[model samples]
Target: MEVNEMAAEECKAVLEHASLGRLGCSYENQPYVVPIHFAYDGGYLYVFSTSGQKVKWMRANPKVCVQTDEAQNQSEWISVIVNGQYEELPGPQYTAERKHASSLLAKRSHWWLSALGERQMRVGDKLIEPLFFRIRIHSMSGLRFTDEKERRG
Candidate 1:
């Protein structure tokens, strides 16, 4: 199918509302996939993580895939697969993106702490330092529930 045939608005909505996805990357020629919380800003996927093994692996290999899905029924579901490259946003971009990401965090009621309210972001004192990453979407493909039905409406 042609890329232009896909619904841009639908894909954007999926990225915005979906909170969890499996991020796929390879290390040492072996495949790895891990569940993560992500926020989308129309063009890129922002993921928050503390420094550790996963971050290290991603740094080594920037190219990755993010897959998210929602089931509407036993026979129907939609999934978006984003194939992109990850890069750590630096300097001014980092500052702005972090604030933007924080707003997204503040709006969500799914988690307990977030539901309670905003906490002070003490940059220097926090043990697990926050990192913001941008995944630049190179290409994406989605499967709709009606794909099998030849439905294009």
Candidate 2:
């Protein structure tokens, strides 16, 4: 198998079509990672989530990493890693940005359901306020792996 570095455009293409990623955050030297659904637009990755451990951790440390990938098999795969800062979109102050995120996320069916449902299950009927945030991408890198034989074929 051979691994090649993906260009910026190629990385962006993956993000555009990817709906799921792993979000990594650190607080006080402790690292935490979680799976999330996101939308990519205009150099940012938008996410809808509930107030939880990740929110608290990210609030303390804005620096984060997001990883997404597609694998066809052991010898073929594409993976992307993004290093960014987290920015929360709150009402009144970020009304416009929030609306934009909502619209972009709406393209995926039930995009908001996972976050809300998980919170509901944990809180037990209490009002679950959804939170919107975006990861301001600072840098991204990607790799593409292919089997040598497949490349020749």
lDDT of each: 0.73, 0.90
Question: Model 2: per-residue lDDT, tens digit, 22-139?
Answer: 9999999999999988999999999988788899999999999999999987779999999999999986989999888888887863735665777688878544567899999999
Name the candidate that leads on TM-score.
2
Best by lDDT: 2
Clashing residue pairs in candidate 2 are: none
Itemize residue pairs with steric clashes in candidate 1. none
- Candidate 1, position 8, lDDT: 64
After superposing candidate 1, which stretches have Cα over 4 Å from the reference? 1-6, 90-93, 109-128, 146-153
Please give the lDDT score at residue 9 for candidate 2.
100
lDDT of 1 by residue, 54-153 (tens): 7788899988999999876545678899999988865784798777876774455236234222332444435455577878988887777644343342
Error of 2 at 17 (Å): 0.6
Per-candidate TM equals 0.74, 0.89
